[model samples]
Target: MPKLTKYQRRITWSTGIGFILERMDAMFMSLALASIIITLHISKAQGGLLPAITAIGSIFGGIGFGALADRYGRVKTLCWTIIIYAIGTAGMGLTNSFWMLCLFRIIIGVGNSGEYGIAITMLSEAFSKKYLGRLSAAAGVCGQVGSIVASLLSAFILPRFGWHVLFFIGIIPVVLAWFIRFHLPESKEFTENRDAIEKDPNRDFSHWTELFATPAECFLTIRIMIMFMIHIAGYNGLISWLPSIAQERMNISVAGSSLWMIATIIGMSLGIMCFGIVQDHLGSRLAYGIWLLAAAASVFLLIIAQNKLEFLIGGGIVGFCSDGMYSGYGTIVSKLYPTEIRATANNTIMSIAKSVGSFSTVLIGFLMDHFSLMAVILFLSGIYLVSFVIMLSIKELKHENKAPVTTTENAEKVAQ
Candidate 1:
């Protein structure tokens, strides 16, 4: 591997920090949902909408900001996304009504969506292809770390200071944005693409139709998007409902559930790191398929675990396999597209998947209300089986010989 320049190092560090902050803010609400519901005197069903709202915002934010990133530049778009999420998070503290809080969360979602794609793109662009998998995995691990921190804060801080304080504390990420804006340079990939466009007098900037111009490109896009949808649906939908599942099915306390979740997050962090290493060595598609299959098996085993210890062990395994593959999605997408439409492609495909997954959350909640927790887990696991098939059937891009690397292609590669 070639030595990374100082600029590349800074971009990676900044992008990882930005990704962590984005994930932390996004998850803080999930950890604190009970507190928010209690403080506002809202029903449990209404409380569920918080994530749905964020998902909805993410659907829009991912596509809109992703396209904007491709057009305006990744660094500039990232700056705006960070600022938006920071203000929205802090604003969560000020809102008293449930509806108002939802509005703030939606705004936060918009920022959260954009932040993810741009940061992933930025980091991927800065690092070499050999390091892309591990770097992207590291970025995801940082996000999981942020979630773990939020979990710890929820466990310790919320009981004494109230949930509002969490949002107020989220303001710290916004402060980090200044450092990002001044310190992080435009990705080398982005600069090259910009220069190419400048040099070409006939280049059209008015529209972006090349993203779906080819059948193979369109097929790959659809397959990946479907994979994301099923992955998120099973992962997010199941995890989001795990607390309630633990409380009702396992007869565990909220604190116990939180600890169990902490264990899962730790497992997820390890899984992501392991997946990255495997992707770098074995390849993304194979690594992803193996993880998904393991995850599916884990979920099925989890459903049959009779005791708390057994359940926790199963959950951890599921976390390791299921959530671990998320980092690979960004890396794969970055490799699949060119720099000019990289963010747009990443955001659009992910957003569509997220939208489907978000809607599935509602369905999962309905299923849980009618069926047992085990039943829901089984259902989600079945969905992962479909994802496994999709993944297995798709063409593995990494195996192709001397793939054409355009300016846009390089930009997408850098951002991965």
Candidate 2:
């Protein structure tokens, strides 16, 4: 197997733990839904509010944590997010009311959402320019492993010990956070930036808004933001609704539905693994464009799929195309910005995209109630086509030996 350097391995494992724990919490929610409803005597609508509200909260968490990771340090801010995530998740186990679960999930959303940008930024900074794409993809692929683990863990824990114990398990990632703080070396770029900031505390490091200070910067930021929005909306809609879609389409029991999730998970993991290398071989826009197009085509197959075998195959292809492009986002955002606000750029945009895009769940639900599941899936396919068109508009920053997008002025130097 291809291996990372020692530094990359440490980063991979640390970030990977966050990914696993986060996905486990998410997957556990589906299994625990019945228990939660019965315990709290809440309506299905009220129960659904919890996840939606949590996603909204994560948008703020991402921006706030991204800024902190920029001004303070990536690892330190990341540790705080872990604490937040653990608290949010574990507290849910103790909730006696629906509102309390909503509150804790909001907290969890912030932490989980914030975790992605900071971890990706750190990995991008730690690796050399040459290794950036694959390592980041590896991190994303690790996240899908988290999903797969969640499915397995949910299958094991939910029936035996019940739901609360599963949430208490959320506390486990705190150990990983501790390891990151004590053992992992801070990124060299972050260390340099911290020193520079201390010497000149007056220097403004917040570049989330300043990203549009120039034409090239504005163009790049807007293009990627639009592209990521479509990606998140389409991907989240599919994953959230897929089990039901599969259960209905395939006429399977809840236990049997794991096959659908597993197939999708495998496809997603493979897609990211493939996209990571493809991004390096092809340039930024083309790599994304290809996958976005494939994603649309895959969804078309999913809607038309007639039998269990066809749907399973279509699910795998959709998962591969839809989620795999996530790795490319890290690659695109990493090269498009400099170290000073790199973390902020990655987190804020992604968080915003996710927050907005997550509404696809509600949208799909509405459409399904009125139209049909096939109609909703067809809508998703059209969204992917839109994403592909948006990808074409992006003017990529050339991956050069020079520090990529270090400053507004420097951004122009690498502009293609």
Per-candidate clashes, comma-separated: 10, 0
Candidate 1 per-residue C-alpha lDDT over 106-148 given as tens digits, one digit per residue, 9 for 90 to 100: 8887877876567778877877667888998888888888878
Q: What is candidate 2's TM-score against the reference?
A: 0.90
Candidate 1, TM-score vs. the true structure? 0.91
What TM-score, over all chains together, does every model reach?
A: 0.91, 0.90
lDDT of 2 by residue, 10-83 (tens): 77787777666655665667556545656788654555555567777789998888988888888778777877
* Candidate 1: stretches off by over 4 Å: 1-3, 41-43, 206-209, 396-416
Candidate 2 wrongly placed segments (more than 4 Å): 1-5, 30-48, 159-162, 200-202, 397-403, 406-416
